[model samples]
Target: MLGGGGSFRGGQDFFGRNNSNSISRSNKLIKSPFDNSNIPPFPSSTATATADQPIFRPSMDTDPDPEHSFFEPASTSPFTKSPWSSHFNSDALPSPADNTSFLPNILMGSLVREEGHIYSLAASRDLLYTGSDSKNIRVWKNHKEFSGFKSNSGLVKSIVIGGGKIFTGHQDGKVRVWKISSRDPSVHKRVGTLPTLGDYIKCSMRPSNYVEGRRRRNLWIKHFDAISSLSLSEDQAFLYSASWDKTFKVWRVSDSKCLESIEAHEDAVNTLVSSIDGMVYTGSADGSVKVWRRELQGKGTKHFFSQTLVKQECAVTALAVNDDATFVYCGSSDGVVNFWEREKSLSHGGVLRGHKLAILCLATAGHLLLSGSADMGICVWQRIASDHFCLSVLTGHTGPVKCLAVEKDNEVSEGERRWIVYSGSLDKSVKMWRVSEQPPSTFQRSPSFIPECSPTAGLLVNAPSFVIREQ
Candidate 1:
């Protein structure tokens, strides 16, 4: 339990040296928040913590209970009226030159306290899927909960929607597949599980197919630890799943066959992003980001080590590749985002300093790069030419922001582009915001320059400056 002072402790232990097998054993290692036995400690300040210290907040006599019953009837009702609305005040808008080019307003906010913390999110068309530690996946349409389903075990950690099917990665190291019924779009049926029973059986017959894991011989097709992230190929013909087991597995979308598993990192593989150019980027707890090039060999594909993009002491926690794959961004526990430009032969671009705590997730919608951090704040960055600058800092969640999903907004004029952004937090709530792709000319400003180079940051030349626009 967290103290009333809201002081954070056990900083390094959260990303400790020990590479444990199961997430449940350590309260520090990222795992299911509903474990009851191992809920990660929460801090109150939104942007107080720094890379080298723990976060602290003023004490309060009545510190709200951070833990809530997963079955709390009042907060669990999906049909309850939304407790959220736009935070944007058109009449009271700030000066464009000092703040965001245009106001990005929150469309709605829903507190699903009974379902546990939202760990992952996926947006496809008009539907939104949210996965939580309660093992339930809730489907939302038009800002209302339309339907939902549950996994018998394991917390849902990651989700991806493509090829007319939905794939969810779980803490139990299994990937579950589902499809929307043609008769009723809301009816999501479990189509199959990865490494289908038949495939598992056939592979088990050959002892040579087994790989050493968790002190036992497990099939090479299976993940022995929690599936931390999921990504899809450009054509949606293949799927990628990263896990805490230190490997990323490839699967054929059509047959759900386990195609390949690469020992990509030495520590827990936290996130993976696949690009259209046959390139895959993976971030790991080992504090390294490696690039792999995919090559077609017969009907199967093999990945070759292309290069190690950036290696540092901070664990790389999240990754995002822009729509065109022109830039790749890696977020770390040190509260900075390191980027590489594809044009510069993947040259190391300067770091973007926004959050004061670990950045847990990153998402890009057009020219905007949104980063959610453990500091309970989301920083919105807009890219102009070769530079990036902070446009806004979204604050509402009282706990660490965990995951994010964004989709294009077509309702606006064709001349202007916008996106619908969904940010999930450990505060047991999800906030939806509308963001413009381009900052208004009056609001446009270059990132503040930091002249000193950081050895860990690697060649900090002309990195984007950060200026927080108060909402």
Candidate 2:
């Protein structure tokens, strides 16, 4: 079940950290509707609070009641659309830019390029795959560029790289699988194509259509109306597909059969991920996030329990699970990033507030969280010794950053482990950032590292190609 609500107001203490009297007093001082003078600055000098600390007070009046909230009427008002689109008309606010003041010796890089905006990104091993609006999926190995992989007839919406294969969801209502081999970089082949119901019918009616006389198998699952996103289980046994039809379908990959289809969301299920413990987390355009867990019985039957974890003020756009599987991070349409810890009951671990526009993507490794936002910036947050989170904002992209992939490199230096963050943006390029150090105190942006683009910078002009072979 999913919930809906008003526009997101970042740094406004939605959890009610401040006293009610102080909140009332501050609200009265700000007269204009657009005035932000009422919002109090986050305390800079306070010590970090423990996870058990009651930092936020859930509002009984405004908070969605679990029983009644799921049945509430969907908002159709144009004014109440996603908050991310609302703030786009206005100038984006700049985040703190001084990297030296917060963390020192941090480096950033740029890797991939495309003619259009990047929609989704996934990385496995040493390879990176980026799905873009250019109707091509590009592969990057090491720091060098490789050939683009073609996917669906329409724009490539999302991609996931795992099991030595690349899975892509397209706007044309088709999912494509490509097999990649390192031995041959110049050749990539598409192995399978899973088309939607209508497309399947069309292909069925016209039987003899291939120039190569090769039949492409369509792993069509009838339940998913329009595939929005996909995720594979830790063991790669189950494939989870979220759809615009507001349901999530779990398919056993061995048989390509739909095992279960749950009404998991109200709006489009835009993002989904699975933990190693068999927990599936989904985010939707309905402004809510839900967690699904499979309940196995002695009778060899499995049941799923879907629960709403956090109801936000805007649609949740992205989700990532930590390596430890202790926390789940979600990025929302309001530019707010939330961390939820696994416990007897799910609880909000912390909130990172800085992005001026909607957060587009989030990736986590170790204790670090990397987030890309529609504001054309990437922010890095590190959990410190005192349980407080430190922030480092990276700025370079001129357009909205749509996706991010993290690569762990252990062979670079002795006991020197680092994450290479690959960010895809609407500015039509992929930028990289290396997070090396944590700030001793608060963060301050350095003036010397301002990002400026050259006039002759080229975008990715290569065609999308995928290696296809008979299964």
Candidate 3:
């Protein structure tokens, strides 16, 4: 479970419930990835220090004690004997039959600390920023700890970067602004916060600026609940934040002014993304994904509800769109990934069934799509035309994968594209992987055809058009 603290809904914890169990919580007490007994000691000479005393624990390479290992001996099959189990192999230990070449190669892993699990991640250029429940944000460059800063209150939940500034949404219902110092790039300073002091005072005097929230009247410019996700507009002119308060707010980036707040869902909004086509997509615990279109109305922008892409009994936990915004993927607590295609008028694309537990986070790099699940595995899918194929499964995390960030590997050749994928997990660690866009071989194999089962209906759903190459 995400032990620190957060909001909950519908008798379900913050991460939602799968079969009435918290998806992010595991009863298993496995050895830490950084356990000294299982791994070699870190070389002090390679450890970098910063003002905040950021610690960089190396990745786990040695074998773990079997009694304390999260992975168990495999049965006859890799997947569970459930209707939802995918045909794609998911063995705790990959066998020789599985094509090792297709798998995303693990680059390294780092333990943030024993106290806080990583909640969010943002990658910009060569720098990777990680946020956690400990109220700290740490920066890494070239897989080494570079710098860090602390927040007085609230665990960092979501982070986004634009215009050389980093925006972090917190559990305290405040969005903080940070910038690197002009003289020292390693030193980060908190410059301002969303709904700044000036805006709060200006809105407080007017009764019209207050809205009923959480059984109390609060400023419409402020969120009274934890901010679950944050996104910036394609043009970087506006910032969007979705909160457990069931509303999504828009702020002008230049002046840090709240422009609009819409009650987007009946329950908490878990994820939100602003696409390049001027459309905003939000998924929530309400079990629906909604789309909105923003337009200039007078001096401010107004968001008009466009459509609801999905509505189900299971809560939608994550959302991601491809580079061109041609496809939108939604992951629900039922361990299914549903997608839609813009060319088909955003119509329902078939589900990408793989994970046996809740999918907590998702990311995209070029034609590659990555889905992180509570099952402690990452599925790498490649998009070809309108269909998707599961290339390989990357497994290592001992807890629910909480967040993901991906950037192109600039060092790769022009003809060969590779992506650097960073996955943050509730295991209090982050793992890096290198993924190739193309398959290792051109040889083709027939894909497995498994019947899809709806979470609530118990009946077979649409047959997926996706293929799972023999692994």
TM-score, one value per model: 0.79, 0.64, 0.76
- In model 2, the Cα lDDT at residue 332 comes to 76
Q: lDDT for each of the candidates?
A: 0.69, 0.54, 0.68
Q: How high a TM-score does candidate 2 get?
A: 0.64
> How well is each residue in 88-206 modelled by candidate 1, as lDDT tens digits?
23344333343443454444343334347778889988989988876777777776556666775477888889899989888788889888878766667787888788999999999
How many steric clashes between backbone atoms does each model show?
2, 20, 2
- RMSD (Å) of each candidate, 1 decimal: 9.7, 19.6, 12.8
Candidate 1, residue 351: CA error in Å?
0.2
Candidate 1 runs further than 4 Å off: 1-37, 40-102, 105-107, 440-471
**The candidate that achieves the highest TM-score relative to the unseen native structure:** 1
Ranking by lDDT: 1, 3, 2
Give the 10-residue window scoring lowest on summed lDDT in candidate 1. 1-10
The runs of at least 3 residues in candidate 3 whose Cα sits more than 4 Å from the true structure, single-residue gaps closed, are 1-104, 442-471
Which ranges of candidate 2 are over 4 A from the true structure? 1-108, 111-114, 181-185, 195-220, 223-226, 296-303, 385-388, 437-471
